[model samples]
Target chain A: MKILAIISEFNPFHNGHKYLLERAKELSDCDAVLCIMSGGFTQRGDMCIMDKYTRAKHAVSGGADCVIQLPAPFAVAPAEIFAKGAIKILLSIPEVSALAFGCESGDEYEFFKAAELFIDESDNFKTIINKKLSEGESYIKSYAEAFEACGGNRDIVTNPNNILGFEYCKAILRAGADIDILPVKRVGAGFGDGELKDNYSSASAIRNNLTDIRISDNIPPYVYNDLKYSADLRGFHSFLRYSLFRAEPKDMQRIIGCGEGLENKLKSLENNNIEKIIENATTKRYSSSRIKRILCANALGLYADDTQNFLGADLYIKPLAVKKTRANEILAALSKSVYPVITDANGKGLSAEGEQCFDKDRYEFAVYNHINGTDKKDYMVLV
Target chain B: MKILAIISEFNPFHNGHKYLLERAKELSDCDAVLCIMSGGFTQRGDMCIMDKYTRAKHAVSGGADCVIQLPAPFAVAPAEIFAKGAIKILLSIPEVSALAFGCESGDEYEFFKAAELFIDESDNFKTIINKKLSEGESYIKSYAEAFEACGGNRDIVTNPNNILGFEYCKAILRAGADIDILPVKRVGAGFGDGELKDNYSSASAIRNNLTDIRISDNIPPYVYNDLKYSADLRGFHSFLRYSLFRAEPKDMQRIIGCGEGLENKLKSLENNNIEKIIENATTKRYSSSRIKRILCANALGLYADDTQNFLGADLYIKPLAVKKTRANEILAALSKSVYPVITDANGKGLSAEGEQCFDKDRYEFAVYNHINGTDKKDYMVLV
Candidate 1:
């Protein structure tokens, strides 16, 4: 009954995602593989290409036994918060003995070593980060530079997955969690690649060029069918653009990632285009992805105070999809779980704050359904 | 020179609107016609067919000496609030001597008589209204029934314009303003008429059957050119539907018109289509238009408390369009006004509550801009 917990967005469940699941089982020797997936919004603040149900079905069809949502707050949060939240849920599951994830580095010890220094969170480390940030480096770059200055492996932080894996390990160490870290080397499709590759195409690449003909080789048959429909982003851009301009500097300060004079810059922008808004809001201290997340949060009326309570740990376990044979097992497991387990998207039994987070996610998911002209009944994808 | 103030939405500046301006000038015998036009959202809670600038330009070209926005809060509010806010602004200007409007009944005494009864707002009158409402009559129906029960002519409330005209006179009486009422008979297509008529089609009719040829006869040459590009309603419908279901019963209660179990009805609805949601939300006690207005306000985050402060009087006077000769005169008149005269959509010098009202209106206006793919520069409907 060895269960491995794999954290993913699985936005469209590309070949690389399938490979990661297979590798998680092979390396961790887990009898059952479960994924904690992002529902509507991804870490980059853009919506997933498809809804959570469809993406979760792809996970089960691909290899996973069960899939639960990573609740929208952390799903669309910054990497540090995203890692902390996911790791918290994984460790809480009781049966999830190991946290399996894909990284550029196959050696798990490499991440743990870096995690040791990063988790220290001493004034010395803060000073180093501030110094790099003051030098006009982006947040990720500043973090990498600070890590190198503190005598850690500088090259590991360059890879996006490795950086996230490091954060996950650090979160686990800080919490003194019992779960072990398992890092699988990414086989193909380097992170951030937006072009098609041999067999393991990057999720972004597949999403960027997703068509009926081009996606078959990249995703499974079920996943390929799932890609037949997608929510129109251009229409959503109007809503986002309206909200961005609607928000005052004070309103921006109340949202995450928009503090520290970012509000001043945003209010000064003259354009209403999303790309242009994000471009103007972006600075050396802030990444475009981070600006997007803040803007997206504002658009959804998700304030900073709403996410404060959920930062330290997972609040609820929301089941999105599971294999037919494993459905009962998953339900039984969730019933005995520590937090409230939400089987329906309505998010019953969640805290007031938790319900707010879930509602934002569900609203975004509803938009996805409206966009694709598809509904929940069509989300089941059999292996 | 006597300034005749005309309150209007001028959604497309149709022949009916032109006739109203002519009738106002002919009856009032004033030198300059000044229109306090609704900006962005109309009283019906729908986005204007074209931007305010274009409509205002048409007003100026047709007969109005100057055109100014009615602001967002008043523009989208109910008839009582709409009438009060527009009259408040009209009275603020020292030179504006008359408030003229189009109505089904050309008799001014008929409107004043109805206004005197309705402005009482006495316990006896409310008891009569509640009695009618207890029978599950619609708000308008209850008002009409109450009017007849109170020894007022029930026929005054039958026509939509007559009812609004009654409210305007009532608001004027309540304020104790010296401005005289000028009532012009509605010459052509009736309110809510949805077909092309002989040179005087309803705005709804023009909007419904808006082909290039069909609209030309209904509106002027410039107004017809404005219709070349139009955004479909489906994009806005997606956002509204998402918000309707996204909100809980309690959340909906915080918005105006969603109280008194309307929130519960909205929450119980399982549909995502705008029409379907409105259909379920509507009962004998609630009309379809009222439901649509509530849903639209909720989607735009306009809450019940937000409107409380603006209910008392006008917050700001904003110029939307002005004829070349009358620009200076309008500016001079506004300079001596009580509240700040806001010339731009940015809403400078407004009170804190005024700012909130302005922001909601501007945000909705931006959505209209994004939907139409037009900018403020094109809003100038020049004479």
Candidate 2:
């Protein structure tokens, strides 16, 4: 069987995500799709507008065969580390044959070449990058300049998919994983663009569309009703800024990519605009993306340094919805399967071991519950 | 010395409200403006966005001289009863010569006449209203029909300001107060338009605008700055709905005016949209406005159906702003003022009496905090 692993935030799984799942299945021709989704906080420091289990269940409903959690630390860490953590876990499963991801530029050869250049960190390239960084430009800018200085094309770094896709390949290469990298061209919408079009929609646009009842029609049928129901229930990112501001200066420092002095700047900016807050706290040495991840981590309570211990790379398939016969078949196969299966949450109360197995999932669910004003129990059960 | 009594919610007092206060002062030629603001909930069931004292302090900082809290039961009751609660308190003070208010139509006479007719109940108005309600029209439509049937102008009741102003006048007459009604024309913006425009903005618009950094220009300087700081603090209302939904159904039924199985409807909507949840629970006989009050009360920790006690109009004059020297002037006047002066709260913490006072204020603060994301301490303090 050609098994494939897909990684995502799936903050609140919607139709676009469903489409990605279908496309990944078609492209990889995998027997089953396994998703490693972020818990609690997302990359941008925004709380996963919905809880992760809700998102994970939605993933199952959207067609994922199983769902496990990306531990909090890497989930909100810098792209390189986030990629490292996710890749390491997937590679642990010797049976996993491929890794499929959505990227801006869908050219696998181009992305892999770029990844090779970044991973090799050739001496001349490193020298040029250091020289550019001394001039106080952001890392992305420095990287582009350095890439050009080294007689390499730098345009790939500018494309959103190329950047992430390159990082995924580098992580796989660094880990010595035989798992193939499958870069699928993102369909439909571009990131940071406000307009919604076709089958492709940016997660940002989808989140914005949720403020009104009318936009509920654009989401998939399975999630449409629930999304509308959740949207109507509460404000989105309503407490994000507040959570960041209220953090103890020490706690703020512990956030991913938020260095020592960054806390002082952030503390001083407690009374400033969100733009000023981000700018004042960020350093030239760090990329804007890094700063954003830090802010997002702070706001979402995903302090990276505090999340060191990682769950092992065992598959935990949470069946959101299954045919009764299929469920029975899957349950029977669990004893013979390569990894331990998590069909139910150890029945209601979580055992310490069970909680350890599912800490990331539980935290993500709690955050979602907090955001939507629902009890944590709402996201726990499968049936 | 002209002293004007303005009954208000001042829920998270913002720039538009500052305009109203300045306009009221100019119209009444009053040196001292006595604001009787709602505490926990409003006529609508939604929370006050901030605690009453915080809002009162903001109002005082903007313009008002003395701020007294309207009890929660009356504050969240129906328009007629809320007006009665406010009028009774205002009437308790003989020095409160002019009662100033904002009216949408800019016509006080029409509203006053309509109020007089309604209060007289001259021609079997109840039967006529019931008949119209049985036909499935909205309660507002039934109200308009009833007014037309009773030899009264329906046009007056259709105007939002006119309706509220009419209720204020009716309460004053019903209480047999000697205070004169002074209705001022509303300016700049309208309420519930679901869009932000001009200097005159609805509280909702002001809140929505706060979510986007670009809209900061529309807010007054102090208000905008305070809100920006507050948003980074914590999710103030994060657990509000959860607490309400988890409360016993019987306890929900105990809320004032929560009649005709509304509690059951609310129980079923534990995880639904906030607006839809409220709307479904609202009956033609019991307006959404009234139901909203009860829901808000439940969130604020007020027991059901405690509307019978007047709570003795505790604490006549709270100093919102002292101006250092103006403090002595207000203190001198309060010493001779007829109503009992309340300088300190009798309880230590959020005791029954303190909860009664603070819950309403906290409820309003919660709404404001939800919008602006400010820390509880960031709100302006009442002396």
Candidate 3:
């Protein structure tokens, strides 16, 4: 039986994510669906739209067999590190046969071609990219222009999910993984769209207008009800502000993804609120999402060295949620996992780095628990 | 010039404190009077009623020629260390001729005899004290009984301020300092009295009844104005709770004064609020003040080893406030002092332990500033 794996934030399991899961199962002819979902923090370097366990429960109720946490510094990391972290988990499990992801273009050949060009770029390709970047083109824009300058497809790297899909392919190629790739076409508005579109509302749309907008048509009922528990960047503002204020430049530069005088800029900022700090830190050189991710990473104590340790490999498997009916089969498959699997925060068998990583997760959860009036012990979701 | 030195919390700078200053001038005929005040954290290991700078300003304006901070872990230590920290500062300067303190019984002879007994405790007296402690007598009770058993004065340790006066004498005697002792009878209801007594009020009375009672008669006009800016422990609850949750047992045990199985009990506590934690931690062996002190020490990162380094002497002299008229005179005296006099939080010339101790003060002020919506850079008080 082939097992299909998906990497996602699932911020709230909407109809688009639902469609992707069903399509993944059909294309891979897989017996089980395994999702490595970003917990508490998201790849955008912002907090989860809702807490991890609620989103995991939605994934299970919507049709996932199991959900594992893609723990930070990967959860709040850049696209490449996020892809590497998720792919590393899949690489460690031999029984996991394929890595499926949703893309707006849904053309695996286009993503493969883009990944190859971007990864195997020569000195000529690098020079064009550097020249474009030096001209103050945005990071993604420069990448797109550089690929186009190299006689690659201009239209391939335009969509957000397709960009992520390309990153996933690059991560797989870099790791020399044997897992097959399955692409499921996204069936809704774009990933960055902040408006509800017919029956396929974007996660951002569902999150921003949570109180007034009825998004039941776009998301499963479990997810709709879990909307009441959704969180934003507000709750972490004061704590992050204090953490940033107490942190010196040297202390901040070690935070994963903080560089290029960003730490100096961050130290000089007058704002303690996350939104205002992000606003102040964002420049042409750094985007808002990138700054948000750096702030979340610093707040969670994720240093560059910690991220480097798990570049193309995972140290542990931390299960966030398990389908109650398929628990036995999932356990049987995971029994042969190459790394230690942790079901709870205090998993005793983790390596020193694994322990440190998990401890950071627990500490972040403790902060979340304190601010949101939740408890850390009840983080596991069963459906 | 016979300069008079006083030690005080002056948590709100009540009229009783004024009485001590006038009485000290009469006794010592001092050219100038100086006060060593606790910073953001007080001797009981709690935040001050107001910011340290504000309190220092009140002290300087009220009558003190200059006000210096007794930086933590000294400011928040128990009686012996508190006395030693204060006396060490006075001992370093030759111009400071005497140590004046408020006492209840007003008997200098009894205080002198008790100080001699405590400072040079005989082997037999030590054995008796240990036996009493082993028999489960309280610390103060054991000390009182041991002194009585050793045929020493029974009346000296009966009053709280008298006991503190004896500790001061003991510290001076142990250090072999030439400083004379001056005792001023407390003109209030009593140190622990919770009721308003004419023009004098206990700090507890003013703090606890700030809402309903008329306290203008009890405190100086400047202190009354500063009352508008007073803060309690409530603001620090969530941050401290998170700090305690993040702290391991070993980490907590390092916090100064966290021993005798206190760290174990602290780790086992379910409450995060300072008041609730203090309530739960209080037992027959420990008082509420001790628990509050422990919690403040832990929150400020004051460790057991930090306390051990300054067991008998302060590492630096930190001046918090100065009267404009006497500023030059005080600066002249401090120039030839045995220890470094630090006027700012970022004092460069300090011993390792001194730096650690002052850093704790600044950090505490940072928390205070964060919670109370103030700034740390504006901490110096000038009258």
TM-score of chain B of each: 0.89, 0.79, 0.92
Candidate 1's docking class is incorrect
lDDT at residue B308 of model 1 (Cα atoms): 68
Instruction: Give the alpha carbon lDDT tens digit for every residue of B293-376 in model 1.
Output: 777777667776767677653476677777877677767876677878776766778887678777776777666665554555
Model 3 Cα lDDT, one tens digit per residue, B44-158:
8667778888888888878888888776777778887888888888888888898889887756667778888876789989998899999998778888898988777766777
C-alpha lDDT (0 to 100) for residue A140 of candidate 2 = 83
DockQ values of all predictions? 0.14, 0.07, 0.15
TM-score for all predictions? 0.79, 0.51, 0.86
lDDT of 2 by residue, B211-274 (tens): 7664464556656656634332123233344445445778877777764677777766656555
Model 1 chain B worst lDDT window (10 residues): B373-382
Q: Which ten residues in a row have the lowest lDDT in candidate 3 chain B?
A: B372-381
Which has the higher lDDT value, candidate number 2 or candidate number 3?
Answer: 3
Better of 1 and 3 by TM-score: 3
Q: In terms of lDDT, which candidate is stronger, 1 or 2?
A: 1
Q: How much lDDT does each candidate structure score?
A: 0.76, 0.63, 0.78
